[model samples]
Target chain A: MKKELEKRTVTGPDGQTFEVEPLIDYYCEAHPTVQPPAYSKIIENLFNWARSESIWILGFGTGCGAIEMRPLMTPRFDAYRYGIQWRPTPRQANLLIISGYLSVKTLKRVIRSYEQMQSPKYVIGLGSCTINGGMYWDSYNTIKRLDDYLPVDLYIVGCMPRPEALLEGFNTLKRMIRAGNAEGANTYAANFDWYKTNQKRVIHDWDMPDYNW
Target chain B: MQQFEWIQIPYSLLTLFIVLNFGLLLNALMAKIAARVGRRRGIPIYQNYIDLIKNYGLRTSITHGIMFYLGPVFRLAGGVGLLLFVPTLYGSEMFSNLSFAGDLILALYFVFFGALGMALGAGESGHPHAAIGVSRGLSQMTMAELPFALAVFSVALQYDTLTISEIVKAQQGSLFHWTLFTNPLAVAAAMLSFLGSMMRPPFDVVLAPQEIPIGPPTEYHSSYLALMQTNRMIFPIAKIVIIMNLFFGGATNWPIFFAKVFLIYLFAVFVGVVFPRFRVEQSIRWFLIWAVPLGVLAIVLV
Candidate 1:
């Protein structure tokens, strides 16, 4: 099993081949020094909103994070009762729930989808993996800090955030919606520095292939 | 709601002749226009007859589902039913004075049912792309129906009778002079809704071939597919005839009626070629936000 796992190598967009495990460990250690209580509260308030309670998710299960969304939607957790159904089309989707790290290949597609969603849409970063590169820290292909590119509303901690933890993240979102605070969406649009910086970094990497196509 | 005697053989024969084939001639003409509008080698005037006979003679593949079997039959039946309901000619009655007070509603419902049956059959045929197409088709129809219904009800209100004959009688003037001119709003709404409902373009998201391989009927093949194609070709003519009879006089000579229906068909073809299909949700949003409000405005004005 170890040998088979060893054979599987995830190449980064920059053509880097750092071992996946150590890359993840080194990245998780580099955490944000500040965790704003106001930010957390804003997330909680969004969940409390009446319309936010039954928030339907755009049913996109891309990676490991996608697997976790299943239980959250099933009977045990039963997200549907809260009006959280999966929408098929981007135009109908109000919330884009990105489950895990996005590959360079998928990142552009995600951007297209994000753009397609009408204004007042929120992006929920589902796992620590999505927060700051998590396990894919040195994987040149995997985007570190998905928020660095796309504005993420709430990032649930956990290499793979548990289903229960996902619920907490959802509640946080509902609270934010209730406060009539569309700050997350606004914040994403306002802060282009992170996206621009990462865009430069990824583009500058000599090994990374041209992404204009 | 009065029951008319059904014992009259002439009534049945005339009903068969008019209802079964009222739109056949008009459809053949429309096909000629469609071919030209599409910039394809146009079929001869008698092409529809050849195709009809070929489809009739061929054995259709019965996909196991009940819907697959029922779709084409319903379209044919609905076409006949709609033709019978519309007031085609005056004084020269056929198949025993078979006019009803609320036949227009029935005619409208028949058109919807036929379109729905085809969509449903296409949806259930185990093709993901087709299913998506059907869903889009249904969504578009849902949007289109609002304006169409509002317009129909407005016309019903004007004549104080649901029958086509009563509606036509109320507009007994020159050929160009009709209820459509009197209630322009309803007429406009009806035309817009009909364009979308018929899945004509911009609204043709249901079967966008480039996007999803003929959409719902993507899996259909051989003769079974032919029935659907035949129905698709023939059914639009029925819809066009109904539109013509309502907007222009149905019996006001072949030339005038054909011209009006052709005009409607021409606009639909232009729309089809000009605009791209709307995303399912976007189309719905458009219908609810714009079409519904416009329909209400038309109703109020009417």
Candidate 2:
């Protein structure tokens, strides 16, 4: 565990001392609950449509495939017109694009980020690597199947999928969302222990909270 | 002065609704214009609305503390308060809103209110990036506001009144009587300061979207983010309305109001597209050296 995250005593400016457990004090330990769809079907549909139209992507480049995402913002692709914006913070983003191979090391951070994101979030397993480890199939550090760890909505399979393929994948995800098919966040909450065990099996040193939120 | 009436509440709300929609559309239009400059297609005009809905629709929302909850609330309040206090149309009773005696001072206070509230709220979030962003934002805002404050004071000095309606009334009757012609230096100073406040290029380091993980709103999400997004639409238009009333002649009705507001907003976009971003210290120095002098001269000449 990090020193900052460890239980310790500290003195304040007024010379008062108090015990502080970093992990307990800093993070919310309550587990995430499965949030049901809106009460009315019509309202749910409206929300789902809005979600599909405004895809705020968390711009965390996990692997080599992240290079492909840059083109989506360029003139040729121009994903902005489609309402796909790249948000720097995980908090503001609803779409997590796991762009390529996820090493055990990177997966730890990815899980943290993924957990921090608000519910109704969708994850995309980008490239062949995230689908089945691609060229790093024999490597010990690489995560073979992305679905074993996170609830992946769609997979754009390629060594590194072209920007066009990624766009197609986004379109498909939008369709899924509009159809009320993409409930990955709920799925993850329902199978929390199963996913946590899978994550812990590969992560080894899982010092952080079970749920980052 | 007109007596306070029970009808003004709904009247003001009507004005708020109009400005809110106008602000959202204007934001998209400016973005489209910026994208066009880069040879790329921009977002749809309705993208802001969709984004707002999507954010509000998110099921889960985490908070650092009570302050985090108030941050966006305060920001929205600041935007709303600024708009309501200032008269929208010059002479129309329906659209005049809640403008009262000495509204210019209140408008100025409201301008800084949101940032202060956000700073406290972001501080409670305990993100280092938020802290850095807040510090940078407040400093930049202070420097940017200097020329604007001076220009406002100069205009108040020029017209010899603090009431916005009176100021607008003075600028009425002819094009040459507008402050842009009557007090060009103050207009120039305020226009330059306007770029800084607009959060576009050259002064956008406060948000620094590429770096520091999006500044003060790093820890904000879901409904909290939705509130801030609402303010983002309203605040800019409110500021533009103040500028329109002060420099250009105040609008008489919805169409004229729309045209003046769009043109003023375009001026900021025009400057934003042409210039590259400046570092915080460099921008502060730029404002002090160039903009502040013009404002001082405006006051001196008046």
Candidate 3:
């Protein structure tokens, strides 16, 4: 149990050395990994066909852009026509929409949520805030680019992208998913350390481990 | 009654295959119809097929010990076993499957197998949401089952035979002879309970995806979810079939069976699309207030 805590002493600019206590007091285990069994080509094709048709989004609603998302469910925009759905839990969601601006506080939760999701997940950096922080570019807490912290498969640009634009983006995502071209999850895992470093730079007093899975 | 034939295995399997596909189609169609109610283009009728495939194709999985893994097995077994035990067509030998295995009482008891398995599996998964869901589900189930139980008891008493085939034979003479006509009060109570059992709105707080993120299946993913999804499709059909057999007169052929089952399934769908969900206590109160009295009256009348 002693190995669980690693002590670090750091000196502030004033040159006073202080013990750095680990901020994380509680622990919940990281999800265990089981190698997904291999499927034959015929089965793979069937899966691809299915994955293309249905996209269950992790409805995190990180920012104001989430306003646009409501219309997708409403009668006017109706994203269900393309088989798009919103899932409350990350485990059931195959897509994550970083809707609009992400504050450092929310990003930490976003990272945790993303990690909890099963593999083959895709991230959509929605609206200009997720692209380059949009109107809040100069805000202290808002992130400039979502791609730096999360492996985003697509970007839907606009101050707040309209529901129609979001629908168009979804169709493109469907096309990409159908072609078996979305490999963002693999890319994220390969460069996980880099993503963590970037994330930790923005988010301090982090309680969670370096990676969720 | 003890004729154990290997041929029945394949026949039961064949019925399972058909019901799986039919259930998928029925759910997708309901989703489409619900969308139309709001004047929107809904998902395609075949979307459930895609969903089942996509779920099975997920590339990663996390197991929460042994019971979580066995949960879906018990669920599917419950659905298939219940179907196999019920005679599909009164006169057809090939489609009989294993109806000789049990009577109506056995079939009624068999309905709990899946729910018990799910509760155990969800409990072991260690998600508080799952536990909350199971509790709500079991509680709601207790209230829902009471009305159905009374109706079943009344029907059994009315027929004076516990065998399902015998009950169906009793209702065979004319459309007017069906329980919907013969025992209108019991059928009304049973259908209301059917809506509750279907997990439609006002009774769907157990899943409450918005509040609990799909409750019991919150921790489930990939092929584990796929197994549950397969059961989701089959279990409802199995439940509806029993209701149809006991109340609507067992179908004489495949087409009649499809029509009857779809109509019964649609009753839940129609209610789901328009109504908001009930809190657990609210649902319990609602069932006790409205359904329980009808069931009691039906029993008193019988």
Candidate 4:
């Protein structure tokens, strides 16, 4: 059983073989639920309501879907109407939107950003590209099934969804939050090892620290 | 009357709670009005409360150091203290709070307590943006305070007392007797400074939300952000109350106080929306070039 899980070794371009820690053994443990307990129903409800209203999204745009997000900030859709704001740093944001196709290089950064964000956070996968790699279905670098790597709370389907669709998606997300159904971060933590294995199989550079935290 | 001693704690707490909530309400109102100007639907009036509660509810946060932990505490303390230091109603002991702590000079200096502590705390945050923000904020604050200090000096010289209550009493009894009418130049200079100190646009480069990603509070989150949010509400109201007392004639009742405070806050919001932000150096130059001469003129007139 002990031998079944071994440290990984990757050869760099410089011909250096470096031993790398697999994310499963080196990262994430299931933590106590962040929400106030059921006994404190009032506090829990208040928290959920607050969380539903104010959603700060990380400003990490991945692909063609990023163009659609700009219109949401314009006079047209105006997502701020729903208390949706974009935060520059991952540390302070609660939502991550994976737009369009994810190339292997971009996926590395996405994983790092997702791990850096505080818990009780979420991941919103956008377009057919994220769902099934869309036009990149046969490409070598673009990921086909995003859920196999990161836990996606919502999958917005389209080649490139319009702003109206994005707004509807936000509304759907708000509803899920109000009902206490969005638990992607917690789900990721609970199944860390399985997710890590899937993530490590692609992109073989494997040079980062064990846990971003 | 002896029982009053026992109730001071609760009374002061009640006043603080009212001010905090009212501050949030006023902020929401201001944001909504600004949104209207831009032809967009804005947030609900009670959104600040929701935001505060949500921040407190965040499950995880990382602290940079002990100073970072105390930064929000210092800011909140300064805001609450500033509010309590002033006598709210003309003749009500119930709302007077701890006004006996000190007088005008103390209140003037107390405003810096928060800024200084916040800068120190942000320094410890280790973010280069926080440091940049602190530098800009402190330098701008130095210039901004000069006009206000001069206006206060003029009022103190005109009234012959540095006690804020006495200054308020001096402005009473007639509509035309208020300093806004009586010392229009001083009020003009001080109000100009007020716009800068409140972090309205043209002077809001420090929190240019999208530009530098919230500047000084870049690393703050959860309850720490909550504390800063509470200060965001109270500190401006507290400063406006001081200016209102010194220049607008202190309110004789609660209704008048609310109207006066709203009107004062509205001026800042109006200015914020119509103009774009001035870079830190430009804003400082703005205060010196325009506001300083007006301040000197007001002082000379007195």
After superposition, candidate 1 runs with Cα above 4 Å error: A1-213, B1-40, B53-62, B95-97, B175-177, B252-255
Q: Output the lDDT of residue B256, model 1.
A: 58
How well is each residue in B170-258 modelled by candidate 1, as lDDT tens digits?
77677456867777777777788877866666777777755675576665543454466556655666677667656655554445545
Output the number of the DockQ-best candidate: 2
Candidate 4: segments with Cα more than 4 A from true spot: A1-42, B1-6
- DockQ-best of 2 and 3: 2
Instruction: Look at candidate 3 and tell me the lDDT of residue A107.
Output: 94
Docking class of 1: incorrect
Query: What is the C-alpha lDDT profile of model 4 across B21-67, one tens digit per residue?
Result: 88999999898899889787777787788888888888777777899
lDDT tens readout by residue for model 3, B179-216: 99999989999999998988778689999988887888
Off by over 4 Å in 3: A1-42
lDDT of 1 by residue, A46-156 (tens): 333433644546666656889988776444675644445565545435688888878876775676566545345678887776888888888978887777777777788
TM-scores of all candidate predictions against the true structure? 0.52, 0.98, 0.92, 0.90
Which clashing pairs does model 3 show?
A: B202-B278
Identify the leading candidate in terms of lDDT: 2
Best by TM-score: 2
TM-score of chain A of each: 0.67, 0.97, 0.82, 0.82
RMSD of each: 23.6, 1.0, 6.2, 6.1
Clashes of each: 22, 0, 1, 0
Task: Kindly report which residue stretches of model 2 are placed more than 4 angstroms away from their true locations once superposed.
Answer: none
**Candidate 2 vs. truth: CA RMSD?**
1.0
